[model samples]
Target: MSATTTTAETAEPAPVHAESLARLLVAGERPPRPNALRTSLTFGWRAMLKIKHVPEQLFDVTAFPIMMVLMYTYLFGGALAGSPTQYLQYLLPGILVMSVVMITMYTGVSVNTDIEKGVFDRFRSLPIWRPSTMVGYLLGDALRYTIASIVMLAVGLLMGFRPDGGFMGVAAGVLLLLVFSFAFSWVWTMFGLLLRTEKSVMGVSMMVLFPLTFLSDIFVRPETMPGWLQAFVNNNPVTHVAAAVRGLMQGSWPSMEIAWSLGWAALLIAVFGPVTMRLYNRK
Candidate 1:
């Protein structure tokens, strides 16, 4: 055979490397690291951008706490708790918890909006880690919760609701409240992904939280409740969390309440974190 023909015959196909073979097998393999910080920052910045455009949503965080403090102090303060001053002290913690819980609803609503708008689809199409979106949402929502907590605390202070436990104690209370809110975000995240509608997630989540808040020791002492409801209230996670906050703020360490609240937060984080992640993966 001629030299050219021999060379052509001797030529062989290129060897396939393991990495390329793996890529071919997987077909559109995602990046090994999702750059969690970048995704979180992106998600958080987008949320802030929305807030900048709307600006009114912050009103709820800023004004509602003040309004609640005033409404409870003036209207039912005297009748329920004998004086506005004592009522302010007694009710402020509950108001703080309520404010934090209420703000978390925004997480679900925002997630639902993203899903409905097909933003999540684009995210999935990218090389981003699936879990990063959820983590970013939780981080962003926590910032909103922190803002709401600060606004409520400021309003409480202005309304004569002083923490007898001093600044450190007050800070501890806020931190616990944020921890609980962070754990609760998982449930809301699951709802957002599963429901895919802001109204539905908001309505259902609020309805569930309304009972937990009212039935807990937030608005009143558990002793004041009926026997059956009191049992439930005493056992409710919100009750423990609120009691823990009040105890911390008053400088009276309620160990049992604190333990229970922390336990519940941990349990919620463990259970709902995986569950919500699974739901997100399924989607």
Candidate 2:
């Protein structure tokens, strides 16, 4: 009877070990393949649904762009760029770039809010693809950015800022701007995850973004700046992005600017994507 008891006790551990092994296997399968495209689309749709339900978020989607267009095109366009017409032509591209940059702050804010509220923890417990959550958020945010871009463009058109590149060129410019914004979002995502509060994410992102935008040739030609500032502006990633947009809108060939913008975007994505994912997994 003692011998039999020993055997049963030994056998009990086998089931426990098997259960543990199974759990480990499940944990190993936690993230799944990144499936960025699929995840982004799903998240984008989710964001759209949220907008549908709330409706008020569209206020920024509509009002901010119109206000920015009018303020820049009428209020400061002439003072900054020589005349309202010429300035509108110049300012439109910068405003578009600014709109894209400004919209990404919401990405960080939303992600931070989710993290703080234990929403991400709930998501982690689900059987869904892990990166899908992040991708979905980004995709939905991109839709907001797209709407903002359209509003800016429409207002620009109303202000007599015709794109020399026409529809195809304008579309290309918008596409590049979105890609750049998407890539830049990684840094903000990292910030959102690292920071304790959504407000911190907003503050840090804006602090970083302000210098990047101001130091670039967004509002004026780079050569017009002093030697040191000009050098920095010439090398700034925002400069590359802004120049690429300007070239596309103005019907100018943008091979170099495009290459630079894409290079920066790709580099940022490579660096921040894995880090953000690791942080997410830890959370």
Candidate 3:
């Protein structure tokens, strides 16, 4: 009878001890919640690593701008400004803005790719803030945008496009372009969540971007268009961004144009950020 009791007591203690050990192990394995900045940086680093593995991912940013600058300056320079040098001065700023804005669409395309590949599920499983993933996507693309800007400007300089705004003005123009690009990224991010495939997101993004960009003063003066088309181009947000960038590069900052561009950026973020967050959470 005593042997039976001793066996039971020993077996009972083993189960309790096993439970205690399990609880401790679980506590150790669970990571502590990270702060927002740290979480964003973590995901941003993840994005950089992804880019490192696929350096060819930057071909659009690097090659597209160079090609556009050479083609447009050579093709349209004589007709537009009587010389390639003069036209480059006019075309580079607008092209810079257009190129950066166009690249922003990739942010959404990448996010959609992650979703389709079940990466978002893994991200959701992590303890970080949900928005951090999206923000990290944006942060990661920021480097790409900056690289595009530098490449475009370098090509422009080689092509004899000198900015009257000099260094400070050029810096201001680049800053404004970055701000607009960041805001534009959110629009794509929202689309990424709503769309099913990366290709669809990119298609819709280009469809929307091409029209706005082509119709705007990025390539030609609004006054040159039909009255109705001129009105639309004048009101287009891309027009304002181009105007602001041009003004800065030309050393004549247009206050009204800058204000309008900033207003549009604020409106984009206010409207799209929440919508994206809600959709992302639903997924």
Residue-wise lDDT of candidate 2 within 1-283, one digit each (tens)?
A: 9999999877853345887878888885455654557656766797789889988988877898788878767787667876888888888898889877877887888889878888888878866677778778877888888998999898889888999999988999999999999888888888889999998998998889899987887777877788998889999998898899989989995999999999999999899989999999997
Q: How do the predictions measure up, each by TM-score?
A: 0.85, 0.85, 0.91
Ranking under lDDT, best-scoring first?
3, 2, 1
RMSD of 3: 4.6
The local distance difference test score of each candidate is: 0.84, 0.85, 0.91
- Residue 225, candidate 3: how far off, in angstroms? 1.3
Residue range 154-202, candidate 1, lDDT tens digits: 8778878888999988889889989999888888888998895789998
Candidate 1 runs further than 4 Å off: 1-34
Superposed by TM-score, candidate 2 places the C-alpha of residue 169 at a distance from the truth, in angstroms, of 0.5
Enumerate clash totals for all models, in the order shown: 0, 2, 0
* Whole-model lDDT, model 3: 0.91
Answer with 1 or 3, whichever has the higher TM-score: 3
